[model samples]
Target: MREIYNELKRHSGKLTEFAQVLVDRGLYTNTKHCVAMMRHSTQFRQDVQDIYAEWKPGKLKTKDTATHNAKLAEVFRSIKKKELKEKVETMCEILEETLMTVTLAIKHSDVRKLGEVKANIENILYGEKQ
Candidate 1:
């Protein structure tokens, strides 16, 4: 019973930590930022779980079993690589929009108009970008 309780506590603690990550990252006014953060946190937790599973002893092992470990490691690496690639793509879109807005404001907006335009763009991008 004590072992079961300990295991429950361990899992609950991990979930609590992941929830905290969501709360902290939720501060971003942008939805994409929130989405990216949550996805990253989830991926990190999954990676940890995969490593833990791999490290635990199996009921049996043969020469083939060693190859299984290597394959699992490759799979984990691939998952992380894919996630990183997605994040880069999202970041590029955000930066491109910001740059385009700034350029348009410079070209067409006057001093007073620029302030209003900037504020509007901020509200649109970062939900009142402080």
Candidate 2:
């Protein structure tokens, strides 16, 4: 049970880090940005789901232990909820940043610059920094 809690805590921390990364590099306004964000979101969700599934079994098996199970359930629920909220907030921040980048690029008469920036940002976000 302690091990399970530790795993949940680790995953939650990773998800929080991923969200922060998304928020930090919210400057893509082209195909790269869209693709990178999509991939990141997909992977993050998969990771969260996997962690939840792992906890679910333990939670079920220990249902007879109401106090222990209830504590586990509460931790699971709280962490998952906070992870989701952070995900949404970070996603929105990314979108807003992308839109702002596009607007600025178009206004400055630099469409090509926008594309370059977008691709670079995507590379950074997706860890394809080559």
Candidate 3:
């Protein structure tokens, strides 16, 4: 149970960082114009905010995985811009891979492998060669 909670907490942190990348990339905005013109306008900002809120460090010690997954799916579905949507979807893939890597590391008790996975995740997220 502790291992599972740790893994979930790590993934949540990654998701928050990814969300910031989206904001930095202009994929998330407080601008009403962008929100209004975008599809699923009503849920856009709030969805992003909810993700950030729920995933903040020290906040996921006891969260329901199913609920978290559902919220993430909704946020992805709310993205209407083709390019931004693709980027977000790609980020989602990265997050899934990171989660799997963490789980595997915990299962095998492989600390070195966990470090490698973390580095891989960073490279993927930042578009850096490693």
Candidate 4:
């Protein structure tokens, strides 16, 4: 579980960097750009789901009681880190929000509406004041 969590943290960091690049490239509107962003976001979401599927909580049992207790303690400690959990949750939220914005932009054919959505996404991704 710790390993999976660490992997998720790393992936989230990568996603942040990727999102910055997309913002830099001005690819925040239009169907093509939205599709590209959605592809990356979808891939990350699926990867997380796959990791979650493989994670089994409280499954680490051992013949040695002392070792089993120690392992359990370690797992609990790792999972109890509030900051790490919050960061993961925030990252997932950002990705989902971006995907939703892109889907909306794709559905609306009005250029002005797409531009507004793009501006909103920029603010969301970059913390820019709107």
User: Which wins on lDDT, candidate 3 or candidate 4?
Assistant: 3
Superposed Cα deviation of residue 15, candidate 4 (Å): 62
TM-score of 1: 0.38
lDDT of 2 by residue, 38-67 (tens): 444433445434544653553332235878
Clashing pairs in 4: none
Error of 2 at 107 (Å): 1.0
User: Given candidate 3, what's the lDDT at residue 29?
Assistant: 68
lDDT of 1 by residue, 1-130 (tens): 2222233235535433433444455444554554344444423455434433453344123358778899999999999999989967776776677667677767875455556656655655675444
Question: Candidate 2 — which residues are off by over 4 angstroms?
Answer: 1-64, 116-130
lDDT over C-alpha atoms for residue 90 of model 4: 79
What is the lDDT for 27 in model 1? 42
RMSD of each: 23.5, 28.3, 27.6, 30.6
> What is the per-residue lDDT of model 3 for residues 23-87, given as tens digits with 9 covering 90 to 100?
66576664343333333333335554554455555644677899999999887777656777797
All candidates' lDDT scores?
0.53, 0.56, 0.60, 0.55
lDDT of 4 at 96: 77
Q: What is the C-alpha lDDT profile of model 4 across 42-127, one tens digit per residue?
A: 33455434534554343333269888899999988888897678866876786677677667767875455556666656766676
- Candidate 4 TM-score, C-alpha based: 0.27
lDDT of 2 at 58: 35
Worst 10 residues of 2 by lDDT: 1-10
Decide which is better by TM-score, 2 or 4. Answer: 2
